[model samples]
Target chain A: MNGFGYLRPDSVHEAAEAYAAHPGARFLAGGTNLVDLLKLGVERPSTLIDIGRLPLDSVQELSDGGLRVGATVRNSDLAADPRVRDRYPALSQALLAGASAQLRNAATTGGNLLQRTRCPYFQDLDKPCNKREPGSGCGARDGVHRDHAVLGHSPQCIATHPSDMAVALAALDAQVELYSTAGTRRLPVADFYRLPGEHPERDTWIRPGELITGVRLPAATAGAPSAYRKARDRASYAFALASVAVVLRIQDGVVDQVGIAFGGLAHRPWRARHTELALLGAPATPAAFEGAVALELAHAEPLRDNAYKVPLARNLALDVLNRLAPAPAPA
Target chain B: MTSAPQPGHHSEVTLRVNGKPHTLRVDHRRVLLDLLREELDLTGSKKGCDHGQCGACTVLVDGRRLNSCLLLAVALDGSEITTVEGLGGDGDEPHPLQRAFLDRDAFQCGYCTPGQLCSALGMLAEAAAGHPSHVTGPTAPSGRPVPLDRSEIRERMSGNLCRCGAYPRIVEAIEDVIP
Candidate 1:
C-alpha cells in the first residue's frame, strides 16, 4: 500500500473540513473497499480521513415513521436491525445476500454506497480502463466482459455497480444524506448513481468534499411485501450475476403500488420505473408481471457472452414479483 | 478536538491483543494482519490472498470477526483483537470447537482452521444475538435467537474457505459443539 497521511476527525464537520483542506483526501469509513484498492494502486489518496470513530453509528426512528440509518453503521448491524428487518425486509435480505459475513461486519453503509465497480479492467492498473483512466480506453469492451453492464453503458465504460444493497434501496426509494462545507442535502438513491456517459470516472453525483452522512428510508415503502433475489456464481461469498429487489402491494386482485430494481445489469441499480408504471393498476397475474418486466427490459443492450444476464434478470424479477403477489390458483 | 491525533504517516496506537494491551507506533500503511504477525509475533492468523476475498486473515475485532488484512492497524487504536492464539483453554485443553474439529478430523491442510474457528465463534455469537443469515426464513423474527441448523451453519460460515474439501466434517464439527 502507498504511504498516506491519516487523520481521525472527531465530528462530521471536522471530517468535511479535513476533506476541503486536503484536495485528494478520501473518507475512510470501513476501509474494506478503499484498503483493497490502495493495495492494487487504484486509489491514490493523499490523505485518509478516518471517519470510523465518528458518532454516526446508530439507526434512529424518524418522526415521520421512517428510519434514518447512520453512515458508519456496519452492514451486519444494519441487516440485523429490528426495524429494518421488520419494515424494510428487502434491504435486510439484500445486505445478507451481499459479500461475506466478515466483510458485512466491517463494511459501513456510506462506504458501501461509494464502493467502486468490480470490473477486472478497472482494478488492473496495467489494463486500459476508461473508468480508471479516463482517456486510456476500455479493455473490458473487447476483453473478458461477461460481467460488464448491459444497460446505461456507453462506449467509454461498460462496468456495472456491484452493490446489492443499493439495488434494494433504489426499489425502496431511499434517500442518501450528504454533509459537506456547503451544508447538508439529500438525494434519492436512484438519482445518486450516474451512468457512464463520458466521464466513467465519476460513479455518483456526489460533489467533491461531500461526506455521506446517512440514508433515509421512507415509511411509504416500508412494511409492504418485498423480497431480494440474487443469482450468483456460487451459493454464497460471490458477486451477483443478476439480482432483483421488488416491493409490491396487490390490492383487490390488482397491483396497488410497485417498485422494482435490478443489480448486476447496469452502471447503477436499474430501477424498473417503466415496469412499475405499467404494473400499477394492472391485474396481479403472471401475464401482467411478464409483460411489465419485458417492457422495462426491452431497452437492454447486452454485450457478447452476457446475453444470458437478460434472461437471468428477467427470471429473477418475475420470480420476486410472483413471490410478492403469487398468481391466483387455477380454478 | 480531543483524542484526535495530528496528520502524519505514523501514529502511536494501543491494541489489546489476546487479553493483553500493547502500545506501539505503526505506519499508516501497515495492516492489522501484518501488525499481529510481524510486530506482536501472533502468527496464528495466516495471510491467504491478502485481499479481502480470502478469510485466512479473519480475527475477532471487538468480538466481531473481520478481515484483519482489510483493517489498518493505525485505524484500530484501542481495540481488542482475538486471534486463533487467544481461543482455546489452558495448554492441553482445547476449546469445545477445537476439540470438535479434532474429533471430526475436519482438516487435511489446516491452513484455514484458524480463520474457520474465529469465524465460527463470531458466527455463533451473531446467531445467538438474533442476526439472521441468508438461509434464515423470512418469517423468522429479528432480535431473537436463530436456530443454528446445518444449513444455517453452512451459510453463516461460508466466508471461510477450506481447500481440503473437509466441509462436511467442518459442518459436523460446528454442529457437534452447537449446544
Candidate 2:
C-alpha cells in the first residue's frame, strides 16, 4: 500500500475544503472497499480524509415519519434499527444479505453506496479494463463474462453494481443528501448512479469534493409489504448473481402500489418503472406478474455467458412478488 | 492543493488492546492486523487472505467484530480493541466459549480458531442485542432477541470458515455456550 497523508477533519466544511484542495484525495469511511482497492493498486490517492469518527453516525426519525440515516451509520446498526426493520424490511433484509457480519459491522451506509464494482478484471491491475483505464480494452468482454451486466451496459464496460443496499434504496425511492463547499443538495437514488456508458470510470454522479451526508426515505414507501430475494452461488458471503427488491401493496386482489428494482444485473440498480406501471391497478395474479416482468425484461441485452441472468432475475422477482402478494380467499 | 504528507513517514498512534494501552510510531499504511501480530507480538490473530474475503483476522473493535486486515492501525486512534488473547480470564481460567470449544473438539488445524472464537463472541453479543440474522423468522420482531437454534447459530457464524469442515462440532460448541 502506498503511504499518504491522513486527515481527520472535525467538520464537513473542513473535510470538503481539504478534498477540494487535494484533487487526488479520497474519503475514507469504514475502509472496507477503499483499503482493498489501495492494496490492489487500483486506487492510489495522495491523501485519505478519515470520516469514520465524524458526527454523522445517527439514524434520526424525520419529521414526516420517514428516516434520515446518517452517512456513517454502520450496516449492522441500520439493519437492526427498529424503525428500519418494521417500516423498511426490504432495506434491512438487503443489508443483512450483503457481505458478512464482520464487514457489515464496519461498513457505513455512505461507503456502501460509493462501493466500486467487483469485476475480477477491474480489480486485476495487469488486466486491461476500460473502467480502470480510459483507453485500455475490457478483458471481461470476452473473458469470464459470466457475472457481467445484462442491462444498461455498453461496449466499454459491462460491470454490474455489487450493492444489495443500493438496490433496496432505489426501490424505496430514497434521496441522497450531499454536502460540499458550494452547499447542500439532494438527488434521487435512481439518478445518483450512472450507467456504464462511454465513461465507465465514473461510477456515480457525485462530483469531486462532494460528500454524502445522509439518505432520506419518504414515508409513503414505508410499511409496505416488501421483500428482498437474492440468488448466489453460495448461501452466504457472496455477491448476488441476481437479486430483486420489491414493495407491493395489493387491495381487493388488485395491485394498488408497487416499487421494484433489480441488482447484479446492470451498471446501476435497475429500477422497474415500466413493470411498476404495468402492475398499477393490475390484478394480483401470476399471469399479471409474469406479463409485467416479461415486459420489463424485454429491454435487457444479455452478454454471452450472462444470458442465464435473465431467467434468474425473473424467477427472483416472481418469488418476491408472490411472497408480497395478498393471499387469495380460501375456497 | 495543500502539500501532501511525504511517503515513508511514520505516524504516532495510541491503541488500547485487551485492557492495555500502547503507543507506537508506525507507518501510515500499517494495518491493525500487522500491528497486533508484529509490533505488539500478539500473534493470536492469524492472517489468512489478508483481504476481507476471509474472516481469520476478525477482532472486536469497541464490542463490534470487524476484519482487522481491512482496518489501519492509525485509523483506530483511541478505540478499544479486543483480540482472541483477551477472551479467557486471568491465570488458567479459560473463557466459557473456549472451554466449550475444547469440550466439543471444534477445531483440527486451529489456524482459524482464534478468529472463530472472537467472531462467535461478537455474534452472541449481537444476537443478545436483538440483531436478527437471515435465517431468523420473518415474524420475529425487531429489537427482540430470538431463540438461538442450530440454524441461527450456523447462519450467524457463517462468516468464519473452517476449511477442515469442522462445522458440526463448531455448531455444537457454540450451541453449548449460548445461554
Candidate 3:
C-alpha cells in the first residue's frame, strides 16, 4: 500500500473539517473496502480521516417510533440488535447474508453503503473501466460481464452495487443522514445512489466533504412481514448473482402495502416502484405476484453473458413475495 | 480539524498483542497483519491472499474477529489483538481447539490453520452472543442462544479457506469442542 497521512478525529465536525481540508481525503471507519482497494491500487487517497472512534455507534429509537442507526454501528451488532431482528427481519437477514462473520464484525453501516462495486474490471488497474477512470472505457461491457449490471446501466458503465444491507434499506424506506460543512440533511435511501447515467465515476450524489452520519428507518413499514433472498454461485461467502428484498403487508386478503428492491442487477438498489404499484390493493394471489414481477423485469436489457440474471431476479422476487403473502387455499 | 492529529505519513501506536504491549512507529499504510508478523516478530498469523478475500490473516481485535490485512495499524491504536499464539493455554498446554484439531486431523498444509483457529474462536463468541448467520432461521428469536449445528459451523467459518481441503475435519474439530 502507498504511504498516506492519517488523522483520527474525535467528533463529526472534526471529521468533516478534515475532509474539507484535504482534497482527496477519505473517511476510514472499518477499512474493509477502502484498505482492500488501496492494496489493489483501485483507490489512492493522500490522507485518511479515521472516524471509527466517533460516538455514532448506537441504534436508538426516534420519537416517531423509527430507528436511528448510527453510522459507525458495526454490521454484526446492528443485525443482532433485538429491534432489528424482531421488527425488521429483512434488514437483519440481509446483513447476515453478506460477507462473513469477521467482515460483519468490522464493517460499519455507513461504510457498507459507500463500498464500491466488485467489478473485476474496476479492481484490475490494468483493465480500462469508466467507473474507475471516466472516459478511459468500460471493459466489463464487452468482456466477462456475467456479473455486471442487467438493469439501469449505461454504455459508460455496467457495474452493480454489492451491498446487501443497502438493498434491504431501500425496501424498508430508510433515509440516509448526511453531515457536511454547511449543515446536515437526509435523503431517501433510494435517492442516495446514482444510476450511473453519463458519469459512472460518481457512484452516489454525495458531495465532497460530506460525512454520512447515520440511517433513519421509518416506523411505518418496520413491522411488515419482510425477507431477503439471494441467488449466488455458492451457498455462502459469495456475492449475489441476483437478490430481492421484500416488505409485504396483506390486509383482508389484499396487498395493503409493499416495498421491493432488487440487487446485483443495477448500479444502485433497484427499488421496484412499478411492481409495488401493481401489487397494492390487488388480491394476494400467485398470478398477481407473477405479473407484478414481470412488470419490473420487462425493463431489464440484459447483456450477452448476463441474460440469465433476468430470470434469476424474477424467480427470487416471486419466491420471496409468495412466501411472505401466500394465496388463500381453495374453499 | 484542529483537534485532529497533524497530518503525517507515520504515527506512533501502542498495540497490545498476545497479552503484551508494544509501542512503535508505523506508516499509515501499514496494515495490522504486517505489524503483527514483521514488527512484533510473531509469525503465527500468515498472509495468504494479503487481501480480505482469504481469511489467513484473521485475528481478534478487542475480542472481535476481523481481517487484520485490511486494518491499518495506525487506526488500531490502543486496541487489544489476539493471534493464534495467544489462543493456546499457558506453558506447553495447547488450546482445546488445537487439541481437537490434532485429534481430528483438521489440517494438512497448516498454513491457514492459524486464521481458521482465530476465526473459529470469534465465531463461537458471536453465536453465543446471539449473532445470526446466513443459514440461521429468520424466525429464530433474537438474543437467544443459537444452536451451532454442523451447518451453522460451516456457514460461520466459511470465511476461512482451507486450500488443503481439510474442511470436513475442520468442521468436525470445531463441532467437537462446542459446549
TM-score of 1: 0.97
Worst lDDT 10-window in candidate 2 chain A: A218-227
Pairs that collide in candidate 3 are none
lDDT (tens digit, per residue) of candidate 3 on A120-215: 999999999999999999998889999989899999999999999999999999999999989999999988999998999999989889999999
Flag regions of model 1 displaced more than 4 Å: A220-223, A326-331, B1-7, B89-92
lDDT against true structure, model 1: 0.92
Q: Output the worst ten-in-a-row residue range by lDDT, candidate 1 chain A.
A: A218-227
- Tens digit of lDDT per residue, candidate 3, span B80-108? 99999999845788899989999999999
Clashing pairs in 2: none
Candidate 2, superposed: residue stretches over 4 Å from native: A221-223, B1-8
Candidate 2 lDDT tens digits, A1-331:
6678788899888999999998799999999999999889898888889998899999998999889999999999999998888888899999999999999999999999999999999999999999999889999999999998999999999999999999999998999999999999999998899998999999999988999999998885533678898999998889999999999988888998899999999999999988999999999999999999999899999888999999999999999999888789887
Judging by lDDT against the true structure, name the best candidate. 1
lDDT of each: 0.92, 0.91, 0.92
**Cα deviation of B153, candidate 2, in Å:** 1.3
Off by over 4 Å in 3: A220-223, A326-330, B1-7
Model 1 has a DockQ score of 0.53
DockQ of 2: 0.54
Angstrom error of the Cα, residue B33, model 3: value is 0.7
